[model samples]
Target: MYHTWMRFFTPSPLHRRLGLVCLGVGLQHGTLPTVGPRTLDHHVAVVISAGSGWYRFPDGRRTTVTAPALLWLTPGVPHHYAPDPGTGWDEGFVDFTGPVTATYTELGHIEPDRPVVPLADAGGPRSVIGRIARAARRGNPLLEVETSAAVHELLVALRRARADTNADGDLVLEALARDACRPLTVAEHAARHGMTPAELRTAVRRGAGCSPKDYLLGIRLGRAKELLAATELPVAAVARRVGYDDPAYFSRLFTRRVGTAPVRFRAQQGRTVPGGWSTRIPDAEHPPTIITGHV
Candidate 1:
Protein backbone atom coordinates (compact mmCIF):
# COMPACT_ATOMS: atom_id res chain seq x y z
CA MET A 1 0.00 0.00 0.00
CA TYR A 2 0.96 3.72 -0.17
CA HIS A 3 0.31 6.98 1.72
CA THR A 4 -0.37 10.48 0.31
CA TRP A 5 -1.79 13.91 1.12
CA MET A 6 -2.76 16.31 -1.68
CA ARG A 7 -4.83 19.40 -2.43
CA PHE A 8 -6.06 20.46 -5.85
CA PHE A 9 -7.15 23.91 -6.95
CA THR A 10 -9.14 25.61 -9.67
CA PRO A 11 -7.82 29.10 -10.15
CA SER A 12 -9.93 31.90 -11.62
CA PRO A 13 -9.31 33.10 -15.18
CA LEU A 14 -7.78 36.21 -13.65
CA HIS A 15 -5.33 34.10 -11.69
CA ARG A 16 -4.45 31.99 -14.73
CA ARG A 17 -3.68 35.20 -16.60
CA LEU A 18 -0.86 35.74 -14.12
CA GLY A 19 1.08 33.41 -16.52
CA LEU A 20 1.56 30.45 -14.20
CA VAL A 21 -0.90 28.79 -11.81
CA CYS A 22 -0.26 25.96 -9.37
CA LEU A 23 -3.05 23.44 -9.69
CA GLY A 24 -2.03 21.06 -6.90
CA VAL A 25 0.72 19.94 -4.53
CA GLY A 26 1.36 16.81 -2.48
CA LEU A 27 3.73 14.56 -0.59
CA GLN A 28 3.67 10.81 -0.95
CA HIS A 29 5.59 7.85 0.41
CA GLY A 30 5.65 4.06 0.15
CA THR A 31 5.17 1.91 -2.92
CA LEU A 32 2.93 4.11 -5.10
CA PRO A 33 1.78 1.57 -7.65
CA THR A 34 1.59 2.62 -11.32
CA VAL A 35 0.52 5.92 -12.87
CA GLY A 36 -0.86 7.06 -16.19
CA PRO A 37 -0.51 5.32 -19.61
CA ARG A 38 -2.78 8.34 -19.91
CA THR A 39 -2.09 11.85 -21.18
CA LEU A 40 -2.57 15.10 -19.26
CA ASP A 41 -3.75 18.52 -20.47
CA HIS A 42 -1.30 20.40 -18.21
CA HIS A 43 2.17 19.96 -16.70
CA VAL A 44 3.27 18.25 -13.49
CA ALA A 45 6.71 18.09 -11.87
CA VAL A 46 6.91 14.85 -9.88
CA VAL A 47 9.97 15.19 -7.72
CA ILE A 48 11.32 11.92 -6.39
CA SER A 49 13.34 12.74 -3.31
CA ALA A 50 14.10 9.25 -2.01
CA GLY A 51 14.04 5.52 -2.76
CA SER A 52 14.05 4.25 -6.36
CA GLY A 53 11.66 3.59 -9.25
CA TRP A 54 11.29 3.05 -12.99
CA TYR A 55 9.34 4.84 -15.72
CA ARG A 56 8.13 3.85 -19.17
CA PHE A 57 7.18 5.65 -22.32
CA PRO A 58 4.62 4.65 -24.95
CA ASP A 59 7.49 3.44 -27.10
CA GLY A 60 8.09 0.67 -24.54
CA ARG A 61 11.41 2.07 -23.35
CA ARG A 62 11.81 1.82 -19.58
CA THR A 63 14.43 3.60 -17.47
CA THR A 64 15.49 3.25 -13.86
CA VAL A 65 15.11 6.22 -11.51
CA THR A 66 16.94 7.04 -8.29
CA ALA A 67 16.20 9.57 -5.58
CA PRO A 68 16.84 13.31 -6.11
CA ALA A 69 15.34 13.12 -9.57
CA LEU A 70 12.47 14.82 -11.36
CA LEU A 71 9.81 13.46 -13.70
CA TRP A 72 8.41 16.10 -16.00
CA LEU A 73 4.89 15.28 -17.17
CA THR A 74 4.39 17.84 -19.86
CA PRO A 75 1.11 18.61 -21.59
CA GLY A 76 -0.32 15.94 -23.89
CA VAL A 77 2.58 13.58 -23.24
CA PRO A 78 1.80 9.99 -22.26
CA HIS A 79 3.49 8.83 -19.02
CA HIS A 80 3.73 5.68 -16.87
CA TYR A 81 5.77 5.02 -13.74
CA ALA A 82 5.83 3.33 -10.35
CA PRO A 83 7.92 3.11 -7.20
CA ASP A 84 9.77 -0.11 -6.30
CA PRO A 85 7.51 -2.10 -3.97
CA GLY A 86 10.36 -3.12 -1.69
CA THR A 87 12.28 0.15 -1.38
CA GLY A 88 9.31 2.46 -1.97
CA TRP A 89 10.02 6.20 -2.37
CA ASP A 90 9.30 9.72 -1.12
CA GLU A 91 7.71 12.01 -3.67
CA GLY A 92 6.59 15.62 -3.79
CA PHE A 93 4.88 17.19 -6.76
CA VAL A 94 3.47 20.48 -8.04
CA ASP A 95 1.08 20.82 -10.98
CA PHE A 96 1.29 23.98 -13.05
CA THR A 97 0.36 25.46 -16.46
CA GLY A 98 0.28 28.76 -18.36
CA PRO A 99 1.32 30.48 -21.61
CA VAL A 100 4.70 30.98 -19.97
CA THR A 101 5.13 27.22 -20.18
CA ALA A 102 5.77 27.69 -23.89
CA THR A 103 8.46 30.25 -23.16
CA TYR A 104 9.96 28.01 -20.50
CA THR A 105 10.09 25.12 -22.93
CA GLU A 106 11.88 27.35 -25.45
CA LEU A 107 14.33 28.42 -22.75
CA GLY A 108 15.19 24.78 -21.85
CA HIS A 109 13.53 25.13 -18.42
CA ILE A 110 11.10 22.42 -19.56
CA GLU A 111 12.24 19.51 -21.68
CA PRO A 112 9.66 17.63 -23.70
CA ASP A 113 11.93 14.88 -24.96
CA ARG A 114 13.59 14.05 -21.65
CA PRO A 115 11.06 13.21 -18.96
CA VAL A 116 13.13 11.47 -16.28
CA VAL A 117 15.79 13.95 -15.17
CA PRO A 118 18.49 13.43 -12.55
CA LEU A 119 19.05 16.42 -10.29
CA ALA A 120 22.22 17.51 -8.46
CA ASP A 121 20.26 18.09 -5.28
CA ALA A 122 16.56 18.12 -4.39
CA GLY A 123 16.82 20.64 -1.53
CA GLY A 124 15.96 23.76 -3.53
CA PRO A 125 13.02 22.18 -5.34
CA ARG A 126 11.76 20.63 -2.10
CA SER A 127 11.79 24.04 -0.40
CA VAL A 128 9.66 25.49 -3.18
CA ILE A 129 7.25 22.58 -2.86
CA GLY A 130 6.98 23.32 0.85
CA ARG A 131 6.10 26.94 0.07
CA ILE A 132 3.39 25.77 -2.30
CA ALA A 133 2.12 23.44 0.39
CA ARG A 134 1.92 26.25 2.91
CA ALA A 135 0.02 28.45 0.48
CA ALA A 136 -2.36 25.62 -0.30
CA ARG A 137 -3.82 25.81 3.16
CA ARG A 138 -7.58 26.15 3.19
CA GLY A 139 -9.15 29.58 3.84
CA ASN A 140 -5.95 31.35 2.78
CA PRO A 141 -7.02 34.38 0.74
CA LEU A 142 -3.66 34.69 -1.11
CA LEU A 143 -3.61 31.03 -2.15
CA GLU A 144 -3.75 31.52 -5.91
CA VAL A 145 -1.22 34.33 -6.29
CA GLU A 146 1.22 32.99 -3.72
CA THR A 147 1.26 29.46 -5.09
CA SER A 148 1.48 30.76 -8.64
CA ALA A 149 4.47 32.94 -7.80
CA ALA A 150 6.20 30.00 -6.19
CA VAL A 151 5.85 28.05 -9.42
CA HIS A 152 8.29 30.45 -11.10
CA GLU A 153 10.72 29.97 -8.25
CA LEU A 154 10.29 26.20 -8.56
CA LEU A 155 11.28 26.27 -12.25
CA VAL A 156 14.36 28.34 -11.47
CA ALA A 157 15.39 26.00 -8.67
CA LEU A 158 14.97 23.00 -10.90
CA ARG A 159 17.07 24.67 -13.59
CA ARG A 160 19.84 25.38 -11.11
CA ALA A 161 19.70 21.87 -9.68
CA ARG A 162 19.97 19.98 -12.93
CA ALA A 163 22.72 17.39 -13.00
CA ASP A 164 23.70 17.81 -16.65
CA THR A 165 24.34 21.51 -17.25
CA ASN A 166 27.93 22.45 -18.07
CA ALA A 167 29.57 24.80 -15.56
CA ASP A 168 31.81 26.18 -18.30
CA GLY A 169 28.74 27.44 -20.17
CA ASP A 170 28.05 29.84 -17.32
CA LEU A 171 31.43 31.40 -17.98
CA VAL A 172 30.55 31.75 -21.66
CA LEU A 173 27.29 33.51 -20.89
CA GLU A 174 29.03 35.83 -18.41
CA ALA A 175 31.69 36.78 -20.94
CA LEU A 176 29.07 37.44 -23.59
CA ALA A 177 27.12 39.68 -21.24
CA ARG A 178 30.25 41.60 -20.31
CA ASP A 179 31.09 42.18 -23.98
CA ALA A 180 27.50 42.71 -25.14
CA CYS A 181 27.83 46.43 -25.81
CA ARG A 182 30.87 45.98 -28.07
CA PRO A 183 30.27 46.32 -31.82
CA LEU A 184 31.63 42.80 -32.37
CA THR A 185 29.74 40.29 -34.52
CA VAL A 186 28.95 36.81 -33.20
CA ALA A 187 31.81 35.37 -35.25
CA GLU A 188 34.28 37.84 -33.75
CA HIS A 189 32.96 37.08 -30.28
CA ALA A 190 33.35 33.37 -30.90
CA ALA A 191 36.91 33.79 -32.19
CA ARG A 192 37.87 35.66 -29.02
CA HIS A 193 36.89 32.57 -27.00
CA GLY A 194 38.71 30.19 -29.42
CA MET A 195 35.38 28.69 -30.56
CA THR A 196 33.91 28.50 -34.02
CA PRO A 197 30.76 30.44 -34.87
CA ALA A 198 28.73 27.22 -34.82
CA GLU A 199 30.23 26.27 -31.47
CA LEU A 200 29.38 29.70 -30.09
CA ARG A 201 25.79 29.23 -31.20
CA THR A 202 25.64 25.89 -29.43
CA ALA A 203 27.13 27.28 -26.23
CA VAL A 204 24.83 30.28 -26.19
CA ARG A 205 21.77 28.22 -27.03
CA ARG A 206 22.52 25.75 -24.27
CA GLY A 207 23.14 28.43 -21.64
CA ALA A 208 20.80 31.31 -22.54
CA GLY A 209 18.27 29.48 -24.75
CA CYS A 210 18.73 32.08 -27.49
CA SER A 211 21.10 32.85 -30.34
CA PRO A 212 24.12 35.12 -29.76
CA LYS A 213 22.63 37.94 -31.81
CA ASP A 214 19.41 37.92 -29.83
CA TYR A 215 21.28 37.94 -26.53
CA LEU A 216 23.53 40.85 -27.53
CA LEU A 217 20.57 42.78 -28.94
CA GLY A 218 18.67 42.29 -25.70
CA ILE A 219 21.53 43.88 -23.74
CA ARG A 220 22.06 46.71 -26.22
CA LEU A 221 18.38 47.61 -26.33
CA GLY A 222 18.14 47.56 -22.54
CA ARG A 223 21.11 49.95 -22.18
CA ALA A 224 19.65 52.16 -24.89
CA LYS A 225 16.39 52.30 -22.96
CA GLU A 226 18.19 53.33 -19.75
CA LEU A 227 20.03 56.12 -21.59
CA LEU A 228 16.83 57.33 -23.24
CA ALA A 229 14.90 57.39 -19.96
CA ALA A 230 17.48 58.76 -17.51
CA THR A 231 19.55 61.14 -19.64
CA GLU A 232 18.67 63.85 -22.19
CA LEU A 233 20.75 62.10 -24.86
CA PRO A 234 19.72 62.47 -28.49
CA VAL A 235 18.32 59.36 -30.20
CA ALA A 236 21.30 59.27 -32.60
CA ALA A 237 23.77 59.55 -29.74
CA VAL A 238 21.97 56.89 -27.77
CA ALA A 239 22.02 54.55 -30.79
CA ARG A 240 25.77 55.07 -31.33
CA ARG A 241 26.48 54.62 -27.63
CA VAL A 242 24.71 51.26 -27.76
CA GLY A 243 26.92 50.31 -30.77
CA TYR A 244 24.62 51.20 -33.61
CA ASP A 245 26.56 53.41 -36.05
CA ASP A 246 23.64 54.33 -38.30
CA PRO A 247 20.94 56.36 -36.52
CA ALA A 248 18.28 55.59 -39.16
CA TYR A 249 18.92 51.85 -38.94
CA PHE A 250 18.86 52.00 -35.14
CA SER A 251 15.56 53.88 -35.12
CA ARG A 252 13.99 51.41 -37.52
CA LEU A 253 15.24 48.44 -35.51
CA PHE A 254 14.09 49.99 -32.22
CA THR A 255 10.68 50.85 -33.63
CA ARG A 256 10.18 47.40 -35.10
CA ARG A 257 11.21 45.58 -31.92
CA VAL A 258 9.79 47.91 -29.24
CA GLY A 259 6.59 49.01 -31.04
CA THR A 260 7.56 52.69 -30.71
CA ALA A 261 10.08 55.08 -32.25
CA PRO A 262 13.00 56.16 -30.08
CA VAL A 263 11.86 59.77 -29.86
CA ARG A 264 8.33 58.74 -29.00
CA PHE A 265 9.51 56.33 -26.33
CA ARG A 266 11.75 58.99 -24.81
CA ALA A 267 8.84 61.43 -24.80
CA GLN A 268 6.71 58.89 -22.93
CA GLN A 269 9.35 57.49 -20.56
CA GLY A 270 11.91 60.32 -20.02
CA ARG A 271 12.52 61.59 -16.50
CA THR A 272 11.94 65.30 -15.99
CA VAL A 273 13.65 66.50 -12.81
CA PRO A 274 12.17 69.58 -11.09
CA GLY A 275 15.72 70.59 -10.37
CA GLY A 276 18.50 69.86 -12.84
CA TRP A 277 19.46 66.14 -13.03
CA SER A 278 22.10 66.83 -10.37
CA THR A 279 20.29 65.80 -7.20
CA ARG A 280 22.65 63.45 -5.39
CA ILE A 281 22.21 62.22 -1.85
CA PRO A 282 25.30 62.06 0.35
CA ASP A 283 26.65 58.52 0.90
CA ALA A 284 25.76 58.79 4.60
CA GLU A 285 22.09 59.41 3.75
CA HIS A 286 21.76 56.12 1.81
CA PRO A 287 19.43 53.47 3.20
CA PRO A 288 20.95 50.59 5.11
CA THR A 289 21.26 47.28 3.25
CA ILE A 290 18.88 44.57 4.45
CA ILE A 291 18.77 40.91 3.44
CA THR A 292 15.20 39.60 3.07
CA GLY A 293 13.23 36.59 1.84
CA HIS A 294 11.25 33.61 3.14
CA VAL A 295 13.12 31.19 5.31
Candidate 2:
Protein backbone atom coordinates (compact mmCIF):
# COMPACT_ATOMS: atom_id res chain seq x y z
CA MET A 1 0.00 0.00 0.00
CA TYR A 2 1.13 3.53 -0.75
CA HIS A 3 -0.01 7.12 -0.11
CA THR A 4 1.08 10.64 -1.04
CA TRP A 5 -0.11 14.22 -0.48
CA MET A 6 0.72 17.79 -1.60
CA ARG A 7 -0.52 21.26 -0.69
CA PHE A 8 -0.08 24.51 -2.61
CA PHE A 9 1.33 27.53 -0.83
CA THR A 10 -0.31 30.14 -3.08
CA PRO A 11 -3.17 30.75 -5.47
CA SER A 12 -3.56 33.01 -8.49
CA PRO A 13 -6.43 35.28 -9.53
CA LEU A 14 -6.59 33.95 -13.09
CA HIS A 15 -6.99 30.50 -11.60
CA ARG A 16 -9.87 31.74 -9.51
CA ARG A 17 -11.57 33.23 -12.56
CA LEU A 18 -11.48 29.88 -14.34
CA GLY A 19 -13.52 28.41 -11.49
CA LEU A 20 -11.05 25.65 -10.66
CA VAL A 21 -8.17 26.63 -8.43
CA CYS A 22 -6.41 23.59 -6.98
CA LEU A 23 -5.82 23.71 -3.27
CA GLY A 24 -4.38 20.27 -2.60
CA VAL A 25 -4.17 16.77 -4.03
CA GLY A 26 -3.68 13.34 -2.55
CA LEU A 27 -3.26 9.71 -3.59
CA GLN A 28 -3.49 6.73 -1.37
CA HIS A 29 -3.97 3.02 -1.32
CA GLY A 30 -4.64 0.48 1.44
CA THR A 31 -7.04 0.76 4.36
CA LEU A 32 -8.32 4.29 4.93
CA PRO A 33 -10.75 5.64 7.45
CA THR A 34 -13.68 7.91 6.64
CA VAL A 35 -12.86 11.60 6.63
CA GLY A 36 -15.81 13.75 7.72
CA PRO A 37 -19.51 14.37 8.14
CA ARG A 38 -18.75 18.05 8.55
CA THR A 39 -19.30 20.66 5.87
CA LEU A 40 -16.42 21.39 3.52
CA ASP A 41 -15.50 24.89 2.36
CA HIS A 42 -14.23 23.90 -1.09
CA HIS A 43 -15.21 21.24 -3.61
CA VAL A 44 -13.21 18.03 -3.58
CA ALA A 45 -13.02 15.49 -6.39
CA VAL A 46 -11.97 12.07 -5.19
CA VAL A 47 -11.22 9.54 -7.91
CA ILE A 48 -11.04 5.87 -7.09
CA SER A 49 -8.28 4.65 -9.31
CA ALA A 50 -8.57 1.14 -8.01
CA GLY A 51 -10.30 -0.90 -5.32
CA SER A 52 -13.52 0.00 -3.49
CA GLY A 53 -14.91 2.33 -0.85
CA TRP A 54 -18.14 3.73 0.65
CA TYR A 55 -19.42 7.28 0.61
CA ARG A 56 -21.78 8.77 3.20
CA PHE A 57 -23.72 11.99 2.90
CA PRO A 58 -25.47 14.37 5.27
CA ASP A 59 -29.02 13.04 4.95
CA GLY A 60 -27.94 9.57 6.02
CA ARG A 61 -27.60 8.49 2.40
CA ARG A 62 -24.78 6.08 1.69
CA THR A 63 -23.41 4.25 -1.36
CA THR A 64 -20.59 2.05 -2.52
CA VAL A 65 -17.72 3.63 -4.46
CA THR A 66 -15.83 1.47 -6.92
CA ALA A 67 -12.67 1.92 -8.99
CA PRO A 68 -12.39 4.32 -11.93
CA ALA A 69 -15.14 6.44 -10.36
CA LEU A 70 -15.20 10.12 -9.39
CA LEU A 71 -16.82 11.43 -6.21
CA TRP A 72 -17.74 15.04 -5.90
CA LEU A 73 -17.83 16.67 -2.48
CA THR A 74 -19.36 20.07 -2.92
CA PRO A 75 -18.74 23.09 -0.78
CA GLY A 76 -20.79 23.36 2.40
CA VAL A 77 -21.87 19.76 1.91
CA PRO A 78 -21.45 17.32 4.74
CA HIS A 79 -19.90 14.01 3.67
CA HIS A 80 -17.83 11.06 4.84
CA TYR A 81 -16.06 8.25 2.99
CA ALA A 82 -13.68 5.39 3.61
CA PRO A 83 -12.17 2.38 1.91
CA ASP A 84 -13.19 -1.11 2.90
CA PRO A 85 -10.00 -1.93 4.74
CA GLY A 86 -10.50 -5.59 4.01
CA THR A 87 -10.19 -5.01 0.26
CA GLY A 88 -8.48 -1.62 0.41
CA TRP A 89 -8.55 0.87 -2.49
CA ASP A 90 -6.42 3.26 -4.51
CA GLU A 91 -7.63 6.89 -4.38
CA GLY A 92 -6.67 10.19 -5.99
CA PHE A 93 -8.21 13.42 -4.76
CA VAL A 94 -7.94 17.10 -5.63
CA ASP A 95 -9.45 19.99 -3.65
CA PHE A 96 -10.41 23.04 -5.69
CA THR A 97 -12.72 26.09 -5.86
CA GLY A 98 -13.68 28.80 -8.34
CA PRO A 99 -16.62 30.98 -9.34
CA VAL A 100 -17.17 29.11 -12.59
CA THR A 101 -17.77 25.91 -10.67
CA ALA A 102 -21.36 27.05 -10.35
CA THR A 103 -21.64 27.29 -14.13
CA TYR A 104 -20.60 23.66 -14.37
CA THR A 105 -23.13 22.73 -11.73
CA GLU A 106 -25.79 24.68 -13.59
CA LEU A 107 -24.89 22.95 -16.82
CA GLY A 108 -25.45 19.58 -15.14
CA HIS A 109 -21.87 18.54 -15.80
CA ILE A 110 -21.42 18.12 -12.06
CA GLU A 111 -24.35 17.44 -9.82
CA PRO A 112 -23.61 18.38 -6.25
CA ASP A 113 -26.18 15.97 -4.88
CA ARG A 114 -24.87 13.07 -6.91
CA PRO A 115 -21.75 12.12 -5.02
CA VAL A 116 -20.46 9.22 -7.01
CA VAL A 117 -19.75 9.37 -10.75
CA PRO A 118 -18.62 6.06 -12.18
CA LEU A 119 -16.02 6.33 -14.87
CA ALA A 120 -15.53 3.78 -17.64
CA ASP A 121 -11.81 4.50 -17.55
CA ALA A 122 -9.65 6.39 -15.08
CA GLY A 123 -6.42 6.57 -17.05
CA GLY A 124 -6.81 10.16 -18.32
CA PRO A 125 -7.87 11.53 -14.97
CA ARG A 126 -5.09 9.72 -13.19
CA SER A 127 -2.54 11.04 -15.66
CA VAL A 128 -3.66 14.63 -15.13
CA ILE A 129 -3.56 14.26 -11.37
CA GLY A 130 -0.12 12.76 -11.70
CA ARG A 131 0.97 15.80 -13.69
CA ILE A 132 -0.22 18.15 -10.97
CA ALA A 133 1.67 16.09 -8.42
CA ARG A 134 4.86 16.19 -10.43
CA ALA A 135 4.61 19.92 -11.04
CA ALA A 136 4.20 20.46 -7.33
CA ARG A 137 7.31 18.44 -6.68
CA ARG A 138 9.31 20.43 -9.20
CA GLY A 139 8.33 23.74 -7.58
CA ASN A 140 7.69 25.25 -11.01
CA PRO A 141 7.84 29.01 -11.18
CA LEU A 142 4.25 29.38 -12.34
CA LEU A 143 2.91 26.64 -10.14
CA GLU A 144 -0.48 28.28 -9.71
CA VAL A 145 -1.03 28.82 -13.42
CA GLU A 146 0.37 25.40 -14.29
CA THR A 147 -1.82 23.61 -11.77
CA SER A 148 -4.83 25.68 -12.78
CA ALA A 149 -4.33 24.71 -16.41
CA ALA A 150 -4.13 21.06 -15.37
CA VAL A 151 -7.37 21.44 -13.43
CA HIS A 152 -9.05 22.86 -16.50
CA GLU A 153 -7.84 19.90 -18.53
CA LEU A 154 -9.03 17.62 -15.75
CA LEU A 155 -12.55 19.03 -15.96
CA VAL A 156 -12.67 18.58 -19.72
CA ALA A 157 -11.34 15.06 -19.45
CA LEU A 158 -13.91 14.23 -16.80
CA ARG A 159 -16.71 15.42 -19.03
CA ARG A 160 -15.37 13.46 -21.98
CA ALA A 161 -14.91 10.35 -19.85
CA ARG A 162 -18.45 10.58 -18.65
CA ALA A 163 -19.74 10.91 -22.19
CA ASP A 164 -17.98 7.64 -23.00
CA THR A 165 -17.68 8.61 -26.64
CA ASN A 166 -15.92 10.95 -29.03
CA ALA A 167 -16.56 12.69 -32.31
CA ASP A 168 -14.06 12.50 -35.16
CA GLY A 169 -14.00 16.26 -35.37
CA ASP A 170 -12.79 16.33 -31.77
CA LEU A 171 -9.47 14.79 -32.72
CA VAL A 172 -8.85 17.36 -35.41
CA LEU A 173 -9.94 20.13 -33.06
CA GLU A 174 -7.63 18.94 -30.30
CA ALA A 175 -4.73 18.74 -32.72
CA LEU A 176 -5.34 22.19 -34.04
CA ALA A 177 -5.76 23.61 -30.54
CA ARG A 178 -2.42 22.25 -29.35
CA ASP A 179 -0.55 23.14 -32.50
CA ALA A 180 -1.97 26.64 -32.63
CA CYS A 181 0.14 27.71 -29.66
CA ARG A 182 3.32 27.23 -31.62
CA PRO A 183 4.64 29.22 -34.57
CA LEU A 184 3.37 26.81 -37.20
CA THR A 185 1.71 27.69 -40.49
CA VAL A 186 -1.69 26.24 -41.35
CA ALA A 187 -0.09 24.08 -44.05
CA GLU A 188 2.53 22.88 -41.62
CA HIS A 189 -0.19 22.03 -39.08
CA ALA A 190 -2.15 20.25 -41.81
CA ALA A 191 0.90 18.28 -42.89
CA ARG A 192 1.59 17.28 -39.27
CA HIS A 193 -1.97 15.95 -39.07
CA GLY A 194 -1.40 14.08 -42.37
CA MET A 195 -4.00 16.12 -44.15
CA THR A 196 -4.06 18.53 -47.08
CA PRO A 197 -4.63 22.25 -46.41
CA ALA A 198 -8.19 22.08 -47.73
CA GLU A 199 -8.97 18.99 -45.63
CA LEU A 200 -7.63 20.68 -42.48
CA ARG A 201 -9.66 23.81 -43.20
CA THR A 202 -12.85 21.82 -43.66
CA ALA A 203 -12.26 19.82 -40.49
CA VAL A 204 -11.65 22.95 -38.47
CA ARG A 205 -14.69 24.71 -39.90
CA ARG A 206 -16.89 21.73 -39.13
CA GLY A 207 -15.54 21.41 -35.61
CA ALA A 208 -15.02 25.04 -34.56
CA GLY A 209 -17.25 27.07 -36.91
CA CYS A 210 -14.20 28.99 -38.06
CA SER A 211 -11.57 28.88 -40.78
CA PRO A 212 -8.16 27.52 -39.88
CA LYS A 213 -6.47 30.92 -39.90
CA ASP A 214 -9.15 32.46 -37.72
CA TYR A 215 -9.06 29.58 -35.29
CA LEU A 216 -5.32 29.79 -34.91
CA LEU A 217 -5.45 33.54 -34.50
CA GLY A 218 -8.15 33.22 -31.88
CA ILE A 219 -5.96 30.87 -29.90
CA ARG A 220 -2.92 33.11 -30.20
CA LEU A 221 -4.92 36.15 -29.21
CA GLY A 222 -6.48 34.41 -26.25
CA ARG A 223 -3.07 33.35 -25.00
CA ALA A 224 -1.80 36.88 -25.56
CA LYS A 225 -4.56 38.18 -23.34
CA GLU A 226 -3.60 35.76 -20.59
CA LEU A 227 0.05 36.72 -20.82
CA LEU A 228 -0.78 40.40 -20.91
CA ALA A 229 -3.10 40.26 -17.94
CA ALA A 230 -1.19 37.81 -15.79
CA THR A 231 2.51 38.10 -16.57
CA GLU A 232 5.30 40.72 -16.60
CA LEU A 233 6.79 39.79 -19.95
CA PRO A 234 7.45 42.57 -22.48
CA VAL A 235 5.22 42.92 -25.52
CA ALA A 236 7.86 41.54 -27.86
CA ALA A 237 8.56 38.58 -25.61
CA VAL A 238 4.87 37.88 -25.19
CA ALA A 239 4.33 38.15 -28.92
CA ARG A 240 7.19 35.79 -29.65
CA ARG A 241 6.00 33.31 -27.07
CA VAL A 242 2.59 33.22 -28.70
CA GLY A 243 4.17 32.58 -32.12
CA TYR A 244 4.43 36.09 -33.50
CA ASP A 245 7.89 36.89 -34.88
CA ASP A 246 7.67 40.62 -35.26
CA PRO A 247 6.60 42.66 -32.22
CA ALA A 248 5.49 45.57 -34.44
CA TYR A 249 3.24 43.33 -36.51
CA PHE A 250 1.90 41.62 -33.40
CA SER A 251 0.99 44.99 -31.89
CA ARG A 252 -0.87 46.05 -35.02
CA LEU A 253 -2.72 42.76 -35.28
CA PHE A 254 -3.56 42.76 -31.59
CA THR A 255 -4.94 46.27 -31.85
CA ARG A 256 -6.99 45.33 -34.90
CA ARG A 257 -8.34 42.14 -33.32
CA VAL A 258 -8.70 43.18 -29.68
CA GLY A 259 -9.31 46.92 -30.24
CA THR A 260 -6.65 47.86 -27.69
CA ALA A 261 -2.87 48.01 -27.67
CA PRO A 262 -1.16 45.32 -25.57
CA VAL A 263 0.26 47.71 -22.99
CA ARG A 264 -2.99 49.57 -22.69
CA PHE A 265 -4.83 46.27 -22.36
CA ARG A 266 -2.61 45.37 -19.45
CA ALA A 267 -3.36 48.69 -17.81
CA GLN A 268 -7.09 48.09 -18.32
CA GLN A 269 -6.86 44.65 -16.79
CA GLY A 270 -5.13 45.84 -13.57
CA ARG A 271 -1.96 47.46 -12.34
CA THR A 272 0.80 44.92 -11.77
CA VAL A 273 1.86 46.53 -8.54
CA PRO A 274 0.38 49.27 -6.39
CA GLY A 275 1.54 51.94 -8.82
CA GLY A 276 2.89 50.03 -11.81
CA TRP A 277 1.01 48.94 -14.98
CA SER A 278 2.59 45.50 -15.05
CA THR A 279 0.40 42.66 -13.81
CA ARG A 280 3.03 39.96 -13.65
CA ILE A 281 3.07 37.78 -10.59
CA PRO A 282 6.56 37.42 -9.24
CA ASP A 283 7.61 33.79 -9.25
CA ALA A 284 9.07 33.24 -5.86
CA GLU A 285 11.13 30.20 -4.90
CA HIS A 286 9.41 27.75 -2.63
CA PRO A 287 10.35 24.47 -1.01
CA PRO A 288 7.40 22.11 -0.88
CA THR A 289 7.27 18.85 1.00
CA ILE A 290 5.96 15.59 -0.49
CA ILE A 291 4.93 12.82 1.84
CA THR A 292 4.54 9.17 1.00
CA GLY A 293 3.33 6.42 3.29
CA HIS A 294 3.41 2.67 2.99
CA VAL A 295 1.81 -0.09 4.91
Compare the candidates by lDDT and give the number of the best one: 1
Candidate 2, lDDT over the whole model: 0.78
lDDT of 1 by residue, 1-295 (tens): 7899999999999999999999999999998978978899999999999999999987999999998899999988899999898999999999999999999999999988999999989999999999899889999999999999999999999988888665667788889988887878999999999999999998888778899899889988888887777677788988988888999999999999989999998889877463643142112224446679766
Residue 86, candidate 1: alpha-carbon lDDT: 94
Residue pairs clashing, model 2: 272-278
Q: Model 2: per-residue lDDT, tens digit, 62-135?
A: 89988878988898878888888788888888877888787767545566878888887888888898888887
Number of colliding residue pairs in model 1: 0
Model 1 lDDT, full chain set = 0.88
Clashes of 2: 1
Displacement of residue 215 (Cα, Å) in model 2 is: 19
Clashes of each: 0, 1
